[model samples]
Target chain A: MAPKKLGLKQRYAHMTRGLDWETTYQPMDAVFPYDTFEGIKIKDWSAWEDPFRLTMDSYWKFQAEKERKLYAVLDAFAQNNGQTGVSDGRYINVVKLFLTGVSPLEYQAHRGFAFTGRHLRGAGPRIACQMQSLDELRHLQTQIHTISHYNKFFDGIGEFPHMHDRVWYLSVPKSFFDDARAAGPFEFMIAIGFAFEYLLTNLLFVPFMSGAAYNGDMSTVTFGFSAQSDESRHMTLGIEVIKFLLEQHPDNLPIVQKWVDKWFWRGFRVLGLVAMMMDYMLPKKVMSWKEAWEIYFTEAGGSLFQDLERYGLKVPKYADVATEAAEHISHQNWAVFYQYSHAAAFHTWMPDKEHLDWLSEKYPNTFDKYYRPRWEMWAEMEKEGKRFYNPSLPQLCQVCQIPMAYTEPGDPTKIAFRCTEVAGETYHFCSDGCKDIFDAEPEKYIQSWLPVHQIFQGNCGGATVPDVLNWYRMNVGADNMDYVGSPDDRLWSEWHAAKTREAV
Target chain B: MSVTAIVPDYARRIEPRDPVENFHGNMLVYVHWEDHLSFCSAVAFPLPPAIPFGAFVSEVVAPAYAAHPEAASIDWSAVVWMIDGATKVPDMEASLAANGMKHKTLVRFWTPGLSGWKGTAS
Candidate 1:
């Protein structure tokens, strides 16, 4: 009898291709140098194999289909007057937070992917990189298109480009990439592909999707899911690249190991913002940061590190640090966000009863002991008709540009501060190395377009919240408020009355 | 091409002075791989030397290639990993051999700021 073949391969083959394929929407260009630079010798570019095989035709077809599905849901929600029906208007602040902080990141991904497609030597790797490049661009575009709908009803969505440039908070992302751009090619792979995509992406993207689902922001959920499906392929490529390098040469191990160590910490440090967003900012919270980090990083990448241990590579130097930080960052970072809400893109009211209860239940060790009292104190101020704002400017970390939320390694409460003198002026930072970076090249960091300084200097729209909100494209309680019986309230009442009559 | 015939880009008028390349890209190297955690770390700290060139590729240059997927299939030769600073490993040649690695040549260069780890040849 002839050998019987299983249906799995045939089934996958049938389902994987044809009209379902989504490829690049943009054209290609020779952006990086191949023969021009003289340092590296290339014998065979084909050795660079991309584990994720993506083509242009398939890329467009699938991507367009996904977008069509998204817009359909968005349109349905809009046509049904979903804005008025939203259970809580305050939840929109989370989306607003996402728009300013996470939205621009899509564009940054687009830029990086495009670079990979052009400069990488191997056809397979290049094509894979190219496809991801397009995927990120689509992500950026779709995110903008989807979020713009909310702009019609909210505020602060318009300030993203300016916020990205001028906001001190934005430096967390800008400087991270700046460091990578200054390195070599192999480092790029380890930093981005291995350290970031393979290890940390699940922790980042999953919370975003869950947050969207919890908050009923269908557009964000849809886009995040669609984008993450592609991330699995990117993650595969990352694993392949690291494995290939480690297996290829012994010297490569130490070099690659060092990169793994550096980038793991670099990537972990950036997650502080995400930790804050997930645990505090999202009104309808899902899992805590500690839970997500342990599953994604400690389990998946940690196992991979065990595999690499035979090849003489240490688990990322910061693995334990990241785990410990993840355990407690939620309360620390959110406290910072709560105090600074007036200056941020989103609004920060006290965590409602349910949210407070959730925190108390989820974080028993530190919530009641430390953070809850702080919010209660703020609530007292609110009762007195006063809002709490940190009047003193936060001393920015020279490297991360964050208001030094990171504490002494194990102790989460003690603030870490480092200082350096440059050009006869003493500058302060949160870490020793950051101060060194500033001191070594004062010219670079001196020109950082800090947001708080910009706002105080009147470079932003105006001095007042209402003025700035308008400039930020926010259409909230100010322009679209309903204190008693305003237009939105009257319209909402009529809609509800008709619904009640229909029910009768 | 003769050594003198090649007017090197970095060190003006160098003739075969042990060529070493760093794959650190420009413009969009650190842009992709957009996990906020990674992005923050890149900004806030001195990145470990694991993939010294990751920032170059991830943020500076990867995006251009991302813009053009159709042209991904191309070929090249020879892989060289450059370590500009210091290492605990003694005997660079033996280390290279043990690691199953080979380079056209190994050039040791001194870079300040990498204090404790600076290479012995410097």
Candidate 2:
């Protein structure tokens, strides 16, 4: 006969705390050598609380059910030829950026969580991280499986893992993860769990998922929903980690605050790529990046910092600068990509007149004044049969690795530049925030694998454009440069034409 | 020969001739240092062309220990300069124009012990 069924709280407590123990043979520090080195003083390990109170049994069962639903949708999407269902061929580039840039980051998250799970001193956070680790791995797998459907029909999606590792632009996300992973365990939690998942995730995830929904990419939407459902729990974990640290000891506040500042800016700079994707790449625009930032960061994040203010915690430094930048970064980044698309692993095209009008409406203050004129010049160039590309590579920031194209704060005329002198050498940053991060840890950033510098150093493929593209595993005409007269464009036209004929 | 004699034609074209107006007012130069294992950092300074390149290297770049702590241990007198990826600016009293330097030009500083210089494509 089976034993009496246990209640939810009892089961969760038993499942999570059952394995933890008081050390008899060895000291706790001896057993967990990795956690305390970062100087985060934990007064009581049992005081650590898991907000979800998730048991492994319930976790596996719930996750399995979600997987079943997601797999059913994935199978249906592939079986029904879902690639054709997207709004336009340009919509696929969004998926390309997601697959190449964002998906691998999930895998990195998986590894990072697993590392923290094993090393953290407390059983509470360890179990939470382990669950999130599995969740990240699942997200990575589902994202790949979903986008692999497009790989069979597209060019750029084929070699994403390789491209993520070696390509120039992909380094932004890669280096962000690498920086987090290289930090100490507590710093890792603050970096990934708190700063990334809690503070800035909505800005990253909501736009893509909503864009997927609007563009009729049902498979992506399903996967996004699945991952995002887990993200809620991760968000709780992020909040819990911050609160746990701040409440533990007074010393933890300053340390946690620094991580918040550094990771917030790092996360913000990385989201510049996403901002550009949201504004420019989507065939059917959801909301402007400015709208998303104002809603997610300004409103929600404002309330969050207010809540934390009682604990002597404050909002991230440079947050106002980031708010000011929301108007221009998307446009600036997209313009850069439009001019340099030949060097990238995805296609770019001039925003049509309607899209430009939408942009002007969305960004009334800055779009028409600064960015519109540049796009109009490019349009005239295209009309004159001279599609322009920047022959020379722009100088990249040593810390963030983005090209030094960011304009001065409040004034978009001059480039914003910040530099610091360390040990008789100079390091340049895109902004004061990035420069501050570099200054705080000169040794860490001094080892950055800047792609432009690597290319100049003869480390990337070879010396020429063809060689670099080959090294990046990109097909020249099919994958790189303008999408106007390419194979994807031709196929899209043919498919639409056939649809019209069939309707007739 | 001084760095001016060996300055590349492309760099020379961009170098400012008017020292007082250009360098003192608005001209900026970006300097970078790299070692064999990819140790690097770039610093930007609004420098006057009237100041000698050697003085800039010694007074400005050498004392910039805060940006690059690794450089503090190294001897600044031993470092060499690569201007705009081509001309090797020697340790002498050459003006910004004399070294073919202009606003926003990148100057790379390295030591003899570092790895061989990999030429940058124009």
Candidate 3:
């Protein structure tokens, strides 16, 4: 027999160490040019510690096992016709949003991490990013495979990838990922890895996974479980990168703080979609958006920042604004969806009496006062055969790309609108947080592709609504309208009726 | 606080994505019906700067807000109109350009008695 196999720690060291070598053909400065431009100082590359220890040898072996488990569940789901098990047809809209809006972001993360892994000089962090890049690719593939079963039985799942690129509301998440990917390597890590993956991923993932479990969707819940282990590794890498940068040099503290502030605000702005799903889309609710925000961001993030206080890193700016917004954003976002239902890929409808009362109970202070009456009025209009869809396109915020629907922080009754003249032209933002972000980097955000502006400029399609609808590839009257009379609704009703008769 | 360049010696002077001239003889203007959160946000319109303000209000803006229950009760002439937050009474017959409404101008109009449905700001 050969020599005894090496211990786990020894094997990890042997595989990771001695991997980075000096460039003989080119200078070290030219090879690792991206790391220094962000003003971060790293005295020693070896000081970078691995948050999780797995070389490519083990990485492939470990991931293949996860793939096997994920696919087995997916096959089982399809064999049993798992689409019929959901709580309601409305719940399919939630999955439709995720497939179109979020899965493409995973693709973006894959590309970002590949760029990051290649550019970073340190072998330790390089290997870390490489593993994460692969994880992201796997996440995107598994998500598509998991949601594809629903595609066979749903109205809105056919055009997910196309919709992600062209849809107006989707620009919110697209722009966010695009901004991060275009930044320097260190900033991408902080923006996506630290701020998004670590800071805010829970708020996004919890509703989808737990909502899937609560609503009896076996395929999606299995996908969530498959991705859970990789997610922990990503969160660990996020913390390690922050600690590595802060510990590397004293000059890095302020730069890291600025990035933390910017991405935290950006992440909060994009989570409004998830907030709406949690509050309105789920037929069987996991929790209210406010409760999820309290648990994920307020309570958990508080102690996290407190831990970082010794490193001279305070909480992100606009934390107070975000806290106040957790209560109102879901309601505001649902109103936007309700009024613009004609333009969306998925169907939209006003909540029923049971749902409205649940929202009122969950959001006692502001729901009845600010939101319930609007729902009641819209519901009444629906009953009277006069469904209200906003005829005009909405004014979008330049930075966030969401419509300017958010109200003032202090006064909920008045809409908050902020604008500034950048280079003698005006740019509008929904809040001071976004305005400040733009003020810092107007050169970057000023080039934002606001979809409404594009549609107005004749870049989308032709002059008519049908022209734009054709460009979006949305099957109007079936894919983009009230759910009550749509094809999906009728099919779901027929299936349940047949099942009821069989039971009798 | 500017964005740090990814590569050294990169150009910094950037152009706005959607500028004034891109709209093809039309200008982008936002109309906010101040207290009506039911419309959800200020509605954006691509209007010719030469369009008369009076006709723009009734032809374009009124149709947008016509579905609201209070739309019928509002006195259009008595509404308080503010252009870009500076209160100004516009000449309804005058063109948008003559009324000082330029690109990205936010025209917020407040109905004297109707804040929102039942004053709930709905």
Candidate 4:
């Protein structure tokens, strides 16, 4: 008989673990320079245990099949003019925000994991990261294809990659991934692989995908399903990498803990956009941002930390502050967008009376108490032929780079302000979490490219708003400002009216 | 504290990206009208340090808040002035530099009775 076909486990073991070799021409340290410099002493490369075994042959085949299925559905979505099927015109702004603010981040993750795949010493994790890197690249491609249909109709999405590099709000997500990509191999793994992928991925992707489902965007939900398989491998690798690093040496715990804490807060700040999207942008609601945070972070991440407690890792620092923030950040972010909508690539509007009542229902304690007045004021101003737009730029935090819009934890009335004097210069922060992050790494934060600072410095093309918008590649009135008289609103309304006429 | 990096030494010294000198003789002064959340956060203006404090108030700070309904009625004498969280009383005729307001200095002012829109404090 032919030699017994190698079983799946044997093949995976041979294909992956059997690939490493001792170097004689160059020392192992020379070959693997990146893994050691991070101060993480890996005692044994062989000791790493992969939670899932996926060889290149199988990874390609599996991913290729998913891509085929995903493309087929996306093709149908485009052919069928699926944009008209969405809940309302306002819903497209959520997609615009994602395409502009988020899709580029997938590409950044791809680059990050590609760098990580080459740098890690262990063959098991190297193969794992390489596969995840390809998965990220594929995810980017699929996300572009998934949302490309919107670009044909939407104003803001036409220059997503351009905007991702330069837009003020897009910088929030861009700088986040840039921070991870610029970190050491070990820190990159912990910051992105563990904290972002395992702990926070559900919180980020679920809102968009579920929002797609609830609002009748089939292609978005379809790609979400396609990417789910790859995400599983990534999540597993995330946990495994954390476990491996922690178990490698006792010294690794503090370093890993700091990365976890830093990335968690950084990721929390970035997710404020998502909070706004779920709360205000989605015409048909899913769970409230507070409710989603409770389920995903409070309940799920609570268990994850409890499990990680065995390795002397407690929950990330300031998790309670982050939890409390979920109640208010959405409103604060929405308000920021509302006043400064003239500068944003997407449209902004005060919610209608019914929508305001929905907000009061969702955020009973805070809505009527703290946030409604601003919305009502803006609405009333619009009625008086004076739609209010903040003429001046707002101050941005040095660490997370969000506008300093967040209020003090206990006091919803005042914007939380924290600052530190580093060297001869002063840096500002939105909260204690960002302050701690800056204090820990003052050298890194002072180099923040705060958009307002850039504009005032005359570096972002010019001194005037029109000049800056030109440099940002913004289409002026077409792309930026309120939704009421926009081309998108007009088209959506025309289509809506035609459908009504046909029904008649 | 320095950046944690594998290559800590670059070819040249690391410089802060937003030093005051980069702004062409102007400093970014952050002004917050306490309890006013409609502007969302403190707004910053690039102004010359030699500009008169009165001009900085009348030209830059006052107009930024002119959109507020109660703006035309506020008592400038009773407005509490704090710079970087410390209460200060500076001469209106003096320069911002003489008033000790430097680059990135946050100037917080409170209008005694006017809290926010309808006292929602937003």
The most accurate candidate by lDDT is 3
Question: Considering only chain A, what is the TM-score of each predicted structure?
Answer: 0.80, 0.98, 0.99, 0.98
- How high is the lDDT of residue A430 in model 4? 95
What C-alpha root-mean-square deviation, in Å, does candidate 3 show against the real structure? 1.2
For residue B56, give model 4's deviation from the true position in Å: 0.6
**B4-63 per-residue lDDT for model 1 (tens digits):** 111345223222211122112211011111111101111211122233343433443233
Question: Whose DockQ is greatest here?
Answer: 3
Model 4 C-alpha lDDT per residue in residues A232-287, reported as the tens digit of each score = 88899999999999999999999999989999999999999999999999999998
> What proportion of true contacts does candidate 4 retain?
0.76
Q: Poorest 10 consecutive residues of model 1 chain A by lDDT?
A: A479-488
Worst lDDT 10-window in candidate 2 chain B: B1-10
DockQ of each: 0.01, 0.03, 0.79, 0.73
TM-score of 4: 0.98
Give the TM-scores of the predictions, in the order they appear: 0.67, 0.83, 0.98, 0.98
- For candidate 4, what is the lDDT? 0.89
Candidate 1 CAPRI grade? incorrect
Per-candidate chain B TM: 0.18, 0.60, 0.91, 0.92
* A101-165 per-residue lDDT for model 3 (tens digits): 99999999999999999999999999999999999999999999999889888898899888888
DockQ of prediction 2: 0.03
